[model samples]
Target: MKKIIFSFVTSVLLLLPNMVKADEGMWFLMFIKRLNERNMQKMGLQLTAEEIYSINNNSLKNAIVQFNGGCTASIVSPDGLVFTNHHCGYGAIAGLSTPEHNYLKDGYWAKTRAEELSPKSLYVRFFVRMDNVTDRMLSVVNPQMTEKEREAALNREMEKIQKENSEGGKYVVSVRPFFQGNEYYYFVYQDFKDVRFVGTPPENVGKFGGDTDNWEWPRHTGDFSVFRVYTDPNGNPAEYSPNNIPLKAKKFLNVSLKGVQEKDFAMILGYPGRTNRWVPSYWVDQQVKYAYPAWVEASKTAMDAMKRHMDKDKGVRLKYASRYASTANYWKNRQGMINALTAHKTADQKRDAEKKFAKWASKDANKAEFGNVLSDMENYFAKTNQESANHNYLSIFFRASRITPLVVGFTKQLEQYLSSSSDQEKEQIKNRLEKNLYAYYDESYYPAEVDLFADNLKLYAEKSSSIPSELSQVKQQYNGDFKRYANDVFSRSIFTSKINFDQFMKQPSAEVLHNDPLAKIATALLTKYYQKTPEEEKLADTYAKAFRKYVKGMRDSKISTTLYPDANSTLRLTYGTVKALPADKRNADVKENYYTTFKTMLDKYKPGDPEFDMPARFVDLYNKKEFGRYLDKDGTMHVNFLTNNDITGGNSGSPVMNGNGELIGLAFDGNIEAMAGDVIFDKKLQRTIVVDIRYMLWVIDVYSGAKHIVDELNIIQ
Candidate 1:
């Protein structure tokens, strides 16, 4: 009977082409020549594969980098001028800004090299090279080995791979699993630590739409920011130094003033963070119904609490600006994902695909390896749905509340002290812990806002089926009102303020830490959240093995021919066209839905509005039509444009280059219509939002009169 079921599914699966669209997939650079170059050229790309990626020669790959390990950025000038999104550099900019300087609010431009500011920590990782390591990696594991044993063996081999490729510790080497661990690849990178800020548009312009228009279409934000990478006198990566100079880049993209047109070829190269395009139906269902909602609600709760205090005090607002924007961005994103996944019926689609896969696996030839894979996954997801939901909420609680870390840190240091060997070692640990405790309090502790954040804990407790016992006990004592409990803790706990912390450090006691109210809450949350249940432990081992076999079967059967591995923060090239969505009357004034212009900015502008307000100079320039060379043939200055190039979170600062490989725009966002692009590409709706490079040049050369900066760029008119 099982064989019959498998035979039927196999027939169905063979008939299907796996539904991978021409424009989908974050392809590896090494495979571009064989897998994508021809298709890309047919779509209008003029550059040869060798011109894009070459291990021994300077190519486009040399100009692109992973910005600070989280975003993409490109080198645009011989002087190492780096271009990326303003939001990508927000943390560094905010750190450099003071109440008096207010760089973020008023905007910043380094008139000369000496004016650029270096934050305490900022780096860019240039991709050196990558190679297939599948055979080497797979040799360490066997089918009969448990998942834990497989993982340990693979990790040991991966460490050896890294060491071999590190070239005496000069390069950072990473071994990443692909196709759910059926294959592996090793990447080599060189990190430059002396990156310095160059320029940015004022907050009003950079974040023009703010939270209200973050993931929405028809965006008018000037979202680009500039930085410069510095190196030692010998042009080697080094720590920050006054003696360091701008790097003479081996390759930098030529800035193209010519704007994009509908159907024009577009390509993006960056480190896309993550994707799960081949997951089973159960995983998608769990994310939509349980995980995403919990995250969305928890994020919103924290955002509202932070905003309330932020609005009341300017200093507080400045301090929490980055956190608020980050929380609110995900708050909208998760909700968008929920709406999109449901609207697109993505789960149903996955289910249909899985049925075909199951049938294929059930065949007599394939039955032994994959027959139980789907059942195991389904059973695991079913039992852990609620637990998964609770886990997300608690995770957000820890991230949202700053106090949790303070308590956790103090407790860990105390534990270390107890385990120490001698009085001298204990004293040294005590001194270091005391210093960190004070610093944490100074930077993050805020009693009023933290107490307000605790309200989220109550929300979690109410929404989750189960919670930490310590949290439950607190709820019982406070009659389920977390606000009172938080207030009591803040008033008495040492982690609440430096005065309290300093006093406690003078006479630190393990009993005090063990009995502290905040410590109890923190310990309960941390212990329960990190400790896996026996069921989860068993499932983890089983799930890993099952998925590995499931993907292997798909490939072995030729069902996923030409399928690229999921994005895992590696250098990849995705190419498509400057595609437009269905014409909306809202954008009737513009030529097409592929891009937006200054007119859209004015239309959405609101006086004194945080998101829409424009700088006086910007408004004056728009009124005078001072677009200069940046003006489009349509006689408008393009702000943000759209393309069908597949991208995700870490692709934020990625360069959106044209056919000739000249930089045209900066890929900063994805349209809300296809927020599910992270998991599944909706070829028709998924579009990468880009800031026109011409607009960035205008902001610096014309609007801000920083032409010296423009003189460094290799501009192609």
Candidate 2:
């Protein structure tokens, strides 16, 4: 989350301690077995025995779908009816909805296929092929080359690869190194540019319990949205077209009516954003103590401020929902991680891992290199900690308000003075500003951000003693009065000062930007101290070299493992058994299950509490025994499934496939107990929770009467 190299290494290294000698010795064997297991049993996967015969075999086809778009989805119908998580399409869905048609609150449904709303920009990709070109790519660069030289060489190599493989097309192709640097794969994708909205349930249905219910099991959230991918007259990817044809996928998943039963193998395939399973204990401790708590507190402060502001202004609430939700997500996740670490033996396990790494390094033939690497890493961690804190503080401040735009404009003016630019470049700068201007109008754009910044400032002030001396001086200037500082910094008007930022927008941007409090702070920080800080320059160079080295090292040491570093944007595959394990040492006996009944939902409800109250539709469904076609093997209706398949943020829309490779469910969230899976993947604690596809179809058929959509599914039942 912090984007530190130490955290990245720690994520992988931490797992090493728990692994036995047999696990290490049989890594290659187990890797092959696991690959075969995934291909045979996982979602949209296919592999032959010959493909798994050896690691060197290139017969296995690429199993993942690629997309220029950010999220993943599955084609449930031959007509190209795509299903993904609601949050995955929230931006587009929200973009198309307004006060007169609040799709988020009331849901959206097209009477006919033609009535589907075409989004401004939406697309999906399918991976056509992948070639192992690592050796060829790296052959252009010397192994002993400097980081800068390697980078320059890599750029040229990539340019050549892209030109040759692109085939004069707009398709996105990326050459990714695997196994540290021991292998390479060239991924070629076919992009479908035309995608449109079909349907989405209301937030009450899709998001259901909101922040409280997120990442928790017995989840009632439907979490489904429907979209259609359209193609041009030539049946190729294209922009929005009134007469576009439906794009048919070469490998689309068939939605299975036979849902997951107990211990049935389930696998998820998509771009799992990130996991920091290899982080050091020091980093983990820092996160548990400082980073997470700061995030939670800041989010709480901002949410409270937004609620107060929104209570008197509906327009403001609508505008800020996205911003509020973003903060709330981080806050909720941080809290979950805190709870998870407390519940589990994460800290103890991390310590054990450090010891194991040290032992292994002693016996390793590359002991000197490994020892130096570890020491360098530790030294880097210690040097960067304070600077990292400072960076976080500044990032939070900049992101919190419109001061960023003003600063950007100021920087552009400075750049223009410093360098001569062509007419095309000048136009690009103008276009970029205009684009950002539209983004500035969003409700959460100003008020929620300002509040978050103000809150973070308070936290920073409290933690000032721990910060670098230079940054501490800046924090001291703020003292402890966040509200006072916020008023001075962000207030464009009295109403805006109170968090009703929509009211403040009545004043022009110039009026606000000229007198805004943060401008002065920005000016002072940017001009006088921050821009010239030795620590800043040193850290920047360090990170630059580190990144280049990381890329080169990955290219050089090609170690093959099923586990891949999350790119935050790319499709991924995760495979594991469904095991109900304890949350932590404190709850050693409690094993998580796939489903929680209506009985469990009712037990948690308090009649008079607004947060706990079930909506009438949900109550009616429960009371009427109207689960439709969603009964599991035991004849009980299921709401969610808790699996051991490792997943995280970008995995929102991933399909949970059965061993037979049938679509059993859609993965949307994980249990709160497994929130730390991003940093330290505890198979014992982490669980990828999915919305049972059976329940989804049941709701569509019985509840919404959208059986036309259901008719498209290839249901076994």
Candidate 3:
């Protein structure tokens, strides 16, 4: 371990003086002292690297956490008051909302700790520490080993390492591969599962522009939400309980009421999800030409189907709100990626980079180890492109349909229950399944709404190259009319209704399941979706090996001057100055293109429109110019601002701090022009959208009159 740390730190120190632009890299926190401390100091940082990521002391890293394993969040108060993006907390908020209460629409504020709501499941993971394990991982395999053998060896070693570092399962330990498979790092995290919802703005303010303004700039969404982490009396992780108390956090960020100005130093700390900056051109081609278009079309189809039902009934809307938002957000994102990648010619850029890499690898010194890497990848992708495309289409067809998951999940459990020989075990499984069915009926099952799955499935059949052979008879019976087939199936399937399910459970048999229409479709879909030939699997293994060599060769040959690994949900810090976009008519009213204000947001408001509606109280506040202490120096209430900080999906709700490490804003969205950023970082155009911390405070303290929540924060005026 010492040797690993010493070698890694030495490499970072050697590259310190010649690193890329401040806005470009998603950098590791452990090497900040060697790689970024001096640069950050020169860029206006007031704290040392030790103060930001120290293990011996409670540093800035202690305040940040992986929210619900998918998003990033931060601690803002000693009582463990957590702040994250509104959309990040959407599931929790929606879970607590009902048609009558509609907290998702009207919003909710917990004036006291007792009023805070707990969702069925939610947790936040704090970064405990990380260390290099590449040498130990690689030591288990050799060139003579097949890909399967190598993978098995690595998994065994990884499992051993995880068990060793888990402190007897107290911490969640993950061994993640970086740069494909060239390096590995094990991350230790302590999860606090007793998080409670505190407050959020209504959709009008929180998700102001909805999907229309999701990735676009000049945004007004107050995309922030409040929650609190709770733990046992001894301040240790625990599940939800009435006896739990608010955690006494190790460190929390001080909220800054002072607003940002163009060129001011900005820094962000969070776990960014993923980036594929080193992917080959063929991979880009596959995404743009096949995978993304299918995803976009299928997602839009689901959105349209869900909207039809949601529009007529408020209950349906409340039930499907979170699911719809997720589908719509990605729907727009995938399309944006297509257009952005095409316009930027990102594939061409990758091809040029690969050309250079191939030339470098051709040298006699490197040829034996890396010469065939690019060719192997090309051959693999060329042969599997169509199969890959069909698989992607079917994947979304399953993902976007509510019925498919329940049908598949329940069927799997039923099959397991049938196979059990022990009467005691069978009874327990039956009871659990019965409980789940009741929960689904009460909370999630909406038959009328899910009827749209027929249309979604029809779209899938039309877009995909082929359907499973098992479903070919049904397709032929209806002459490929999926709507008719789906209707016939839904009218008879036992899984479609609780009474039917109860009756079927009394006479459980494999024959009945085989004869069931929905079950047949589910079975066929699963079989075809996962069916890959052995030859194709072998090609995938070959591709993986080649890609790893490609990445390692690029680093060793100095093709990638700054060898920072791509993001894999690790804690990283990115710093840059607050930046402005090119001048545009839409943002002409603003003093600069970097920031947006209430007046501009109101200008785009549409009365009674789901995407652009303005709350009555918000209008009154704006009309009265009731800016209060949250107003910017220019006399307008700033809403969202731009920074050049390198960020991606999981970075949503990350704290965008000033050089002094004071929280100024919460990073929420990215500009649409740089949608291809996941594949390539365009420093010139890519920007991180942030909600001003003052705006969040104004909403909680002034608008909602939650003065006690405001008082918990260490506010810097």
Candidate 4:
């Protein structure tokens, strides 16, 4: 969610005399600032002087823990109890429950350590250290090389780096490019293969108002989950084992009672996904006018059909809640962004900036690359702009249905094939496939998806008449004749399963064999008047190249930015400072701060309103002012905090640290205003939200009465 700054007034400056040069320089300055803001600086964060001194003096890096196999987390206890967001551990919790044992609905608690539930597959990872390997790695690649040559060189460099760093174990090492092409960090991490679920609250508490309250503030969703890591008899990471011992983290955060107050210094460390701050203005306008709106409409239509089916089918709802929630969440966020973008006049500003840059580049030789790239991007957008929105929709729906599952299945099968001699591989593959099957069966509607494609075909037919009168008759022929279309197109395919798909791929004319249901729909839309069109393939290749170029450009630019490579199951450290800021145009004057009490929660309550109803447990806790042992720095109530840390999807369970590196909170959500933080993060507006460590301990001590687990924590009150 990159927020673009667009101002129409600035657009006119592009044609102005002296102002054009100033505007061009300002754009570059902005770009540099953005890059520096997101760059990794080891333990260094964007903190105030006092905050920096605090973390440098007191922070304990070992407190951070990777959780439940995939997500990031931090350990609060020495005996193995770990803390992370409820959403991070939701899948495992949801997976273990049946209709009768609806953990998601009623929640679950292990009364004793012996009764704690073991997840079939869960693990945690811990970061060891980061080493500077910029020159050592990039020395192998020529800077002036082509994209393909650069990619190959990078791959070779990474292989060498991994080999040299390998400890002759299961540890993974990754070389990450940072600040565009200016720096590189090599990270080594050990991933624990065994982790187990400990506890979670009911949906009423964990999810609270569900989607209605997802990204909103003054919130009361107790988004927390508990899990424990286990090691084998030899103290080695392994699969679930009864004989396994609790993991002893090299570093763990001591639980703190002093919580964040207004303007408190805080920071979050986690992996954040993509951002689009550097995109051209034309691209931004296209997304605003065409891309986001079209997808939202398509998603709405699909959701309606899915929800209608779910209402009549309980099994479908139960199995597809995760999928639905994922889609619904995106839909909500995108809508919010659309509104915010318009309010901020982002598109207009971007257009103005682009024109100014172009004018400046016309004179400057050294800075010509900036304007040239901008021009290329705009040209590319113009060529593919009309089809881009529909392309995304097609990709999403089709990938959700067929491609993703195939890829996952293929990966699992490959792992199994490679480990044919190991019995554990077979067991792991079986478990993975079983879970995937449930996911695929629950969320995918093969017949309905095909029908949706059929509908899209007809819609395209109606629209294609505007393209050319020569193809008008052809468009009319397929306007309502999907039955014939499907038979003639899809029926010619042999893409039923992996085996068939693989066989088709091996054929000399494999492209001809790709006439599946999805392809039929694509062909109907792309081709005009009985003539085949290569537009689809051409657009696909262009997009692929664009993405690759973007990645390559980041690697070569040497700009200090956080646009790093993906996590290759390796340990990495990210640093940023914690600060509260206004939510851009919406709450520009109001400071985003901590802990809206039960009082604030109650104020939003409407007795007859089912959506706003508080659960009895929450109400009771509120009435009791069950502050328990948790209290803020000022001895007032505690809730959440804002940090200027950059993070992403994989950073779910990451630790939020103070300047001293002590664990103050567990990083969870970013403010709704900062939804676009992933791309073009704004230090002024972006803040990572976290559940206070004090609050977590209070729940364990006062609510669950899990003193045994509580005793494990080194509580620093």
Candidate 5:
């Protein structure tokens, strides 16, 4: 262990000074002191590296957490007040909403702690510490081993390391691979499961601009939500209970009401999701040519199907609101990626870089180790490209089959109940299955399921190269008429209706399940997928091995200077400066000032529109010019600002701190021109959109009249 630590620290110390850019790289916190502290200081950082990340004492890392494994959040008050993006909290908010109250549309404010609502499941995990265990992990791996053998050996060591660090499950420990298996890091986290929703602006303010303004610039969405973490009286992780008290955080960030100006230093601290900046051009071709188009089409199909039901019934809207948002967001994102990647010519750029790398590696010693890497990757991609559309279309259809999951879950228990001779045991199993089926029904309503099922079948036929042999008869009988086939199946399938499903479960039997149309589809499709998995996995392994060698060779040849690992939802620091964008380069209609104001946001408002409607009180306040101290000196309320910080998916809700480590804004979205950013960071065009902290405070104090909640925060002006 000591040797591993020493080797990791030495490697970190050897990092080249000028290799990394101030505006690029999602850096690990552990090496901040040795590698980034000086550069960060020169860029206007005020705190020491230890103050940013330390295991023994309170530091900035304590405040930042992985919110539910998907998004990032920060501790803002000593009472465990958590701050994250509105869309990040949308699922929980939608779950708590109803047609009558509609907390999502009207927004909600907990005036007191007692009024805060807890979702059925919502949690926040604090970063405890991290250790680079690369050497230790590689000790069990060797070139002679097959991929499966290497994986098994590594998993054994990881399990032991994780268990040792878990402290009897008190802390969650995970070891994630980085740099294409070239490095490994151990992350420990403590989760508090008693988080409750506190306050959120109405969707008008929170998600303003909606789909129309999704990735566009000059952004004015508030995009922030509030929650609080609660723990046992002893300040340990605990489930939700009335007796649980608000967690007294070891450290919390103070909100800086003094808004950031253009050229002001901006740094983000959070768990960024992933970036594929080093991918080969061949894979990029696959994504652009085949994979993404299929995903975009299938996602749009699901979104439209859900919207048809949601728009007509308010209850359905509340139920499927989050689903529609998630589907639409990604659908648009893929479309944007296709356009942006083509316009930016990212594949061409990647080929150019690869050419340079090849020239550098032409020498004898380098050639022996890395010569076949690029060729092997090319071969793998060439083969996979043929099936890309088919794979994605089929995969999407399987996932869009919501009730299929319930059927699978209930199938195992039903089989058990059938085999049991004891009446008591059989009855118990039946009871368990019924309860869970009901729960799944509520989560995925019957109307939505029927629509989604029909949509999936229609899309699968439209895009997939071949139909499952089991379903071929049905397809042939209908003469490939998807609508007719869908209607017939949905009408017969018990899975589409809750009452029918429940009644059928009362006399559950394998014969009935085997005959069921939905079950047959799930079984046929899943079996077909698994049957092809071995070959598919072999091709994937080929890509993985080649990429790993390619990355290592690049490092050895000095073709790749900065070697920061891609994000795997781990804590990282991305620093840059608040900047402006050229809205139009041809005519230069707008230079896109760093800040957006309420007046501009109001200009885009449309009455009674789901995306643009705001409460009358908010408009009234604006008309009266009821500006508080939160306003700028020019008497305008700043809504959003732009920064050049390097970030991606999970960085949503990350605190955009100033040079002084004070919260200036919450990093939310990236500009549209930089939609190709996940593949290649365009330093000239990429911009991180942030909700100015003052806007959040103004809505809390003046709009929601939740000054008591505001008083808890350490507000710095």
Candidate 6:
């Protein structure tokens, strides 16, 4: 009973709200009624827990989907019309964009099914069910076993259990640990591969305010996108094929045209990627003081290099647009997190919790289960800090370089070719290299690549624990002039041009690769990495043992508190009210900005601006007051809104639903003031920014001129 209660506190899987407030949790639906139903009902939930998560019948869970592994999406029509965020679908949009048919610059719409563009590698997954496998998993090990022994035993059962219950490879089975391995749950999923892009507003409409407005409230960005899921005629998950038809949605959410108001109930259901509200104070200190600064600096440098190339050419921009946005968003995310965590004194707060736990463990009755946990964790972090810093700092060079990926791939293939005895194996590998591999690097610009190479090499030399010994010699030979060194490496590299790549393909050999300048650099760097980290590995083993004990202690001490595991990209539901920041810190007056209007969007609008520009069609509709059925009584078209729902990265396109299970908005961004939300929940400051469902409908109906798509939705007025 004590263990179960503790599992409820730290795991994101637990529905019980034992934190700041009921609104602070990204809860699992399975335990809703048992822990949260009364409070939820009192707060204005019209649907029962069964109506939200039942497996025997259609429920709210049937409508929500994991969008392409990153964002969330909702089925809005019986024919499987899906709604998600524009940025969530940014990659798919960018892939479909070309200079002649720039769907990114000018919006895209498919009046007919044939016009819907299907990108090569985008898929959505549906959760079939979840099962508590805690007892079955925990039965395999006991306190006497070492972490290695326990893992080996658990692995044996994991394979058998997954194999036994996967429905003959039809369902994707995942068994994830929760509450720091105190509990486990099995989730079954079905992946649909035929999702197609239905419509997207132009850059100005979809990405209004762009970076400036991201993570800000009073936001005006119309950050929504449309999609359609296709499955076999029998309505089964299938690969992309011409024979597939639109999926018959088991359940679909109705779009609410009424919008939101102050104190209105709002809930979100989606896959929230991760959260670490239970991490130790030392870990938070590591990120805030040591690690994140390097990441922010290196990422900003990489983004600058990519943006330089993207700005030079339209085709390059099309290829790198999504990459750049992803880079920029996270770079700023790290910067903001550093600032927010410092302001909140998150580490100090975590230390207080640790102190409480330490006192609890100091009790003689509890000492055996939690002895040395705090000290062990402290030493583990201290020991691993240098290794982590070196790896993260040096890893950016490979991440930022186009040539490194190709070289890595080629080097692997060359090594394999040398060892393989079969003629057919070599031939097969060569064919793939000729056909698929070389074409991927077409978007890379030589000048940017050269510059990035020099910059990263310089950065590594200055920051990494030790530069690769070979590269150290090369640095001396070049008199520490990395620019000239970069030119020498790029100029000699066979991957720099198609002419050289073609030559290398003809006589690919391990000897040639062993002598290659880039390959030598890769080898020396990887060698240094392996040589640098024997101590951290041992400390990590110690940390893992101590972590389990600490969690056990936390559970024992928090017997009265509800505990939940941290998030691990599983489906969750979080509920809260339409809320706002205090208008000013000076008074009791709170500014509950429930929604934004098109008229307000125009206030921040600038003609021909990359971030704020709008298509003339949208401008014309706004000018003429053409909001159709999607406007409020005040005659303003809604664009975006705010809710206090808890969400993180993977919940981007989650449905912001009303009391009656109708879609009101799409969850997109989180407020910057609570950027450290992944580490700690700031109940008062945290807010999920959502694009108003009415605004999405109006854009589909008016701006994009896709009324047919609007007609598909079950619009609730």
Among the numbered candidates, top TM-score falls to 3
> Candidate 4 on 1-717: residue-level lDDT in tens?
011123322332343332221101111111222332223223343433322212223334455655644567777776677888887777778677776787766677777767788865677766555566767656776536654576688788888888788688667787776433434667766778777777876666666657787776646566788888778877778877788888876556766666655544455544434445655466666777767775666556456545665666655555555655667767777776676566566667666655655555455652534434554565667876666565555444442334322543444364454447776875676556546544544444444434444444444334322333422443466665854554443344333233444454345242443334434433433343224257644544444344434444433342313233443333334444545555343332223444544455566665445346655665677777777667554554555555666565666667776545567777666667766543345456655666667766666666667767777777766
The local distance difference test score of each candidate is 0.85, 0.61, 0.87, 0.56, 0.84, 0.81
Query: Could you tell me the lDDT of residue 89 within candidate 1?
Result: 94
Which candidate achieves the best lDDT against the true structure?
3
> Which residue ranges in model 1 land beyond 4 Å of their true spot?
1-22, 417-439, 584-586
When sorted by TM-score, best at the front, the candidate numbers are: 3, 5, 1, 6, 2, 4
In order of appearance, the predictions have TM-scores of 0.94, 0.78, 0.97, 0.72, 0.96, 0.94
lDDT-based ranking:
3, 1, 5, 6, 2, 4
Model 2 TM-score (2 dp): 0.78
lDDT tens per residue, model 5, 146-168 = 67788999999999999999999
Give the Å error, residue 686, model 2: 2.2
> Model 6: residues >4 Å from true position, as ranges?
1-20, 142-149, 402-406, 419-423, 527-532, 559-562, 585-592
lDDT tens per residue, model 1, 1-717 = 334335534553454344335578898898677667767888899999999999999999999999998999999999999999999999888878776887888899998899999987899999999987887888878998988898899999999999999999999999999989987889999999999999998999899999888888888888889999999999999999999999999999998989999889999999999988878788889999999999998998888888888788766677777878888888899999999999999999878777878889989998988999999989888988888889888878877886675577777777788777789988897788767766555445375456555777888889989887777788899898788777888777877777877687678777887777788777778888889877778898898888888788776776654368889999999988888877652366556778888877788888898888888888898888787788988888888888888999999999999999999999989889999987788877888889888888899888988899889999899
lDDT value for model 5: 0.84
Model 6 compared with the native: what TM-score? 0.94
RMSD of each: 4.3, 7.1, 1.7, 9.4, 2.2, 3.0
lDDT of 2 at 267: 61
**Tens-place lDDT digits, model 6, residues 138-251:** 999987776778889888878877887788998888888887787788888899999999999888888889888777667888888899999999999888888899999999
TM-score of candidate 5 against the unseen true structure: 0.96
lDDT-better candidate, 2 vs 5 = 5
Q: Which digits, one per residue and each the tens of the lDDT, describe model 3 over residues 33-98?
A: 878888888888999999999878999999999999889999999999999999999988988888
